[model samples]
Target: MILSTLDLNPVIDLTDEQFYQLCQANPEVKFERNANGTLVIMSPTGGETGNRNFEIGADFAIWNRQTQLGICFDSSTGFRLPNGAQRSPDIAWIKQSRWQALTPAQRERFPPIAPDFVLELLSPSDTLPASQTKMQEYINNGVQLGWLIERKTRTVQIYRPGKPVETLNNPSQLSGEAILPGFTLDMSLVW
Candidate 1:
């Protein structure tokens, strides 16, 4: 995706509601907000990216369904991070307890909570540094685990709190570890 950022600072600092309204008004567009209130617009994915995203989401959904561990969100689901940024990871999951703690109202709109796990797939228009920065943002905002997958290079960068990122090359699969027990992402499907 070709991600664009627009700074609406000093001129128009949109509140959470206004941002949500803008997104609702333009459902065809995907928007994200940085901690500085800059809006990031994401272009729609091409066939390869879309199909890969779907496959990743399906695996996550299936795992969640079987475990009844938490809720799974696709790319369209926006989350209000603790640091005042709005993000929509390619695939996200929240622990069941954490999800159940939210009020119905909170659940209806962008839930003001960081997901326990997040995944971002590098698209054709994406750069390594940009994707790495986004993944770091997730970690700083209290995400327990994250993966940045680059199909072109067949590599995966793993993120975790208080640790340096772990990079894997052509790994057969990924284990969710204790964070998502028994969940293994089959790299064959992704690669």
Candidate 2:
């Protein structure tokens, strides 16, 4: 079930540390924090969505291992964006140099940097508008590349800084473009 902004107001606001502790305390629940300090507690995805997420993450993992281009993360990795939002994309990658710049403590907690690349796979419960807004947020927070994939519509929205959002309908695959260099996501399994 989707929790609207109105439903979140009554909940006690939490400091970043408190939110991190809460997440650690309840490892099974997925949580996100908005720029305005709204806490979002999300339910786990269904089996199909879970499987698709796994496949997508696996592809990134494999690519990272081969090229050693950067660090790759699954959905569970929380990132503290520059805009003060704590978000965890379905799949994310950070440049090695950028990741190395973080102190060990910062790396241990919610990382205080936006990923170089991010992918969000839309599940049945996810609202399209919300997801699009999130993609825009990533761009605003210094993410170089972002993909919002909608399985139901078989469409992908590509986000790049200073460029208009590009939409691809039923694409066979998606290129990482200059950001990832040679990494391509095969959509055959994704769709």
Candidate 3:
């Protein structure tokens, strides 16, 4: 199923702590907060999408283990962006230095920083426009590199700071570039 968003305008606004509690209470549900405070409730992905997400996360994890240059996170980790949005990318990475800057307490909660690199894998239920908008948000909030992979079309949208969005069609692999030197994602498993 597609994701659903709720705008709780008439109701009292939920404080960050309250949101955290709510999330903790509902462990089975996936939630996100937009910069404007809209609550997004996303359903669990289908089996195929879940498997793809696992494969993508595993690839990043292996690369991270080899390089030790950064920490990789799976979809379940939430990050509080500078713009006040709480986002959980399908796959995310933060530089070791940036991660080390956070205190132990901060690391235990949703990190209040943008990820250096993010990857969003599009499931069949996801809309292209919505995914593109999310990528733009990530870029605007200081994400240096972002990838929106659309399995349906075999297309990848690459987002880089201060650069126009680049589109690749059916690419066999994606380079991590300077941001993640010596890292490459094999598209065979993802596609």
Indicate which candidate wins on TM-score.
Answer: 1
Residue-level lDDT tens digits of model 3 in 1-191:
24789888469688778888889999999999999889999778889999999988888899899989999998889999999889999999999999999999888989988999999998878888888989999999999999999998899999999999999999999999999899899999988
Alpha-carbon RMSD, candidate 3: 1.0
Candidate 3 positional error at 2, Å? 4.2
Candidate 1 vs. truth: CA RMSD? 0.8
Candidate 1 lDDT (Cα, 0 to 1): 0.94
- Arrange candidates by TM-score, descending: 1, 3, 2
188 Cα displacement, candidate 1 (Å)? 0.8
Decoy 2 TM-score against native: 0.94
TM-score, cand. 3: 0.97
The TM-score measured for candidate 1 stands at 0.98
How well is each residue in 1-191 modelled by candidate 1, as lDDT tens digits? 64788998979999999999999999999999989999999988888889999998999999999999999999999999999999999999999999999999999999999999999998898889978988999999999999999999999999999999999999999999999999999998888
TM-scores, in order shown? 0.98, 0.94, 0.97
Estimate every model's Cα lDDT from 0 to 1: 0.94, 0.90, 0.91
On residues 1-191, what C-alpha lDDT tens digit does candidate 2 reach at each position? 24544235467767789889989998987888889888777767888889999998888888889989899988899999998999999989999999999999999999999999999998888999999999999999999999999999999999999999999999999999988988999998788
Q: Show pairs that collide, candidate 3.
A: none
Q: Whose TM-score is higher: candidate 1's or candidate 3's? A: 1
